[model samples]
Target: MEIQLKLYGSSKILSEKETLDIQLPNNSDIKKLRDILTKIISEKYSRSDLENLPKTAAFFSEKDEVIDDSYKLSNKEYISIIPPIGGG
Candidate 1:
């Protein structure tokens, strides 16, 4: 199945895209998706960098409502990620 993914803020700098097409299993949970993204991010940057990031450093959603990190996802579902913003 294909999922729609969106990366925002600093994550965009690392990911280099506002959105992407993620192909996964039929029904993958957030944990699995997270694992996949972690691998993807690690490929772009360092795994330590991604590990040091706060959970709130990024936001995940299946639709509009905020979903728990453990939430499961369906095929072709939209998953948007908003990395933490920085400012003075």
Candidate 2:
């Protein structure tokens, strides 16, 4: 299955790109996607850089609804990874 990843805020900065398209096995879950993302980031940058990723970053579906790590991703689903917003 192919998933479209949309990066925002710090995720965009850290990933060095605004968007990415990744291929995974069928019935993959959010946790697997997260692991793949970590691997990709670690390969492009470093393990330490992966640590720099915001812990509060959220994963949303194409509908802009937040989904849990156990959620199974469908083929061609659009997933958005948005870092926590901060303001005073």
Candidate 3:
């Protein structure tokens, strides 16, 4: 299955791309997707950055609905990785 990922904030900086197209095996869950993303980011940046990824970012489905690592993804689903927002 193919999935589309939208990167935001720090994630965009780590990945060096606004969007990424990744191919996964059938029945891949969010955890698996996250691992793959981590690998990609780690290769481009530092391993420490990958460690902070899950803590600093939020995941969303194609509909912009927040999802957890256990969420199961369907074919062609779009995932968005957004970094934490701060405002005073």
TM-score of each: 0.70, 0.80, 0.77
What lDDT does each candidate get?
Answer: 0.67, 0.78, 0.78
> What's the residue-level lDDT of 29 in candidate 3?
86
- How many clashing residue pairs are found in candidate 2? 0
- In model 1, pairs of residues that clash are none
Task: List the RMSD of every prediction in angstroms.
Answer: 2.9, 2.3, 2.2
For 36-88, candidate 2 gives per-residue lDDT tens digits of 77777767765563464635567988888999889999999888986777878
Off by over 4 Å in 1: 46-63, 86-88
Query: In model 1, what is the error at residue 12, expressed in angstroms?
Result: 0.5
Top candidate on TM-score is: 2
Error of 2 at 63 (Å): 1.6
Candidate 1 residue lDDT tens string, 1-61: 8888776665565555678777777778766776777776667676564553435554466
Which candidate do you rate higher for lDDT, 1 or 2?
Answer: 2
* Candidate 2 off by > 4 Å: 14-17, 47-49, 52-55
